[model samples]
Each structure stands twice: as C-alpha cells, then as structure tokens.
Target: MSDNMFEFAFNPGEEVVIKIKAPDLKNKMGGETLQHLMGAKREMLLALRSLLDDAIARTDAADSPAEKTHIDIE
Candidate 1:
C-alpha cells in the first residue's frame, strides 16, 4: 500500500500486481525519468484495458459450455 507500488488480487487464489516507481526505474528503459514514467503509465493502462475487455467478453459468454481451466507453467 505504498505510494510507489500497488498490489491487486484478482481472485481468491489468483493475484495481479503492478508497481511503477519512476525514480527507481531510472535508466532502465530508453528514455528520461519523466518519459519512462509516462510511458509506463500508458503501457499499464493499455494492459488493464485489454484485461477488462477480455473479462467482459467472458462474462457475456457465460452461457457457453466452457469448462473451468487452469494453466500451470513454471
């Protein structure tokens, strides 16, 4: 719950977290601090958008006879 990091639990046993700290990411990507900060935000937004869209599609397709699935790849 810190200011620079965020943790999200998508399901009871599933988890998804996203942390973006610009100062800590200095010189990591090919850009300045501010640029990297903004880029990270944009990328994160796009990723979340895609995830939400997929969730919506699945929800609307609840009538489909798809069995529960789990993939474990380590």
Candidate 2:
C-alpha cells in the first residue's frame, strides 16, 4: 500500500554488524502505527526462531551423507 518498506543488512567481520531501517510512522502510517507493527514483528520473529531451531535439530539428528548446505525460505 505504502512505498515505505523495511530494510536490513548484516555485515560479517570479527564481529557481525546488523542494521535495520526504522519505520517512518509519522510519514507512513500517520500516528501510533509503529507500536502495532512492532508487536506483530516481535511475534513473527519469535515464531521464526522456534521454527529454525526445530529444523536445525532435525537436520542434526538425521544420519545422511548428503548434508544441507543452504536453505532458502520465502
């Protein structure tokens, strides 16, 4: 609906540096929208973390010569 979109970047070095674009609530959603969006984002991230952990456990438990090198979820 709006042109506004979230952006994230991760840079790897001795330590990983992560960057994220903060939402422009005033310009994009008028007022008080960021709070609602953030709540949803938090829940989504928690769910994603749980899913990834389960997948990793399953992969680790499987005894197979073929190993998973990459996974793409969209």
How many residue pairs collide in each prediction?
Answer: 0, 0
Indicate the TM-score of model 2: 0.44
> What would the C-alpha RMSD of candidate 2 be, to one decimal place?
12.8
- lDDT tens readout by residue for model 2, 1-74: 23434344456655433333445556656345767887776886787689779989899888556766897899
Specify the highest-TM-score model's number: 1
User: Which ranges in model 1 have alpha carbons more than 4 Å from their true place?
Assistant: 10-31, 63-74
In candidate 2, stretches whose alpha carbon ends up further than 4 angstroms from where it belongs are 1-26, 64-74
Name the lDDT value of residue 56 in candidate 2.
93
lDDT string, candidate 1, 19-67, tens digits: 5443455455455766867787789878878988999998889967878
At residue 22, give the lDDT of candidate 2.
49
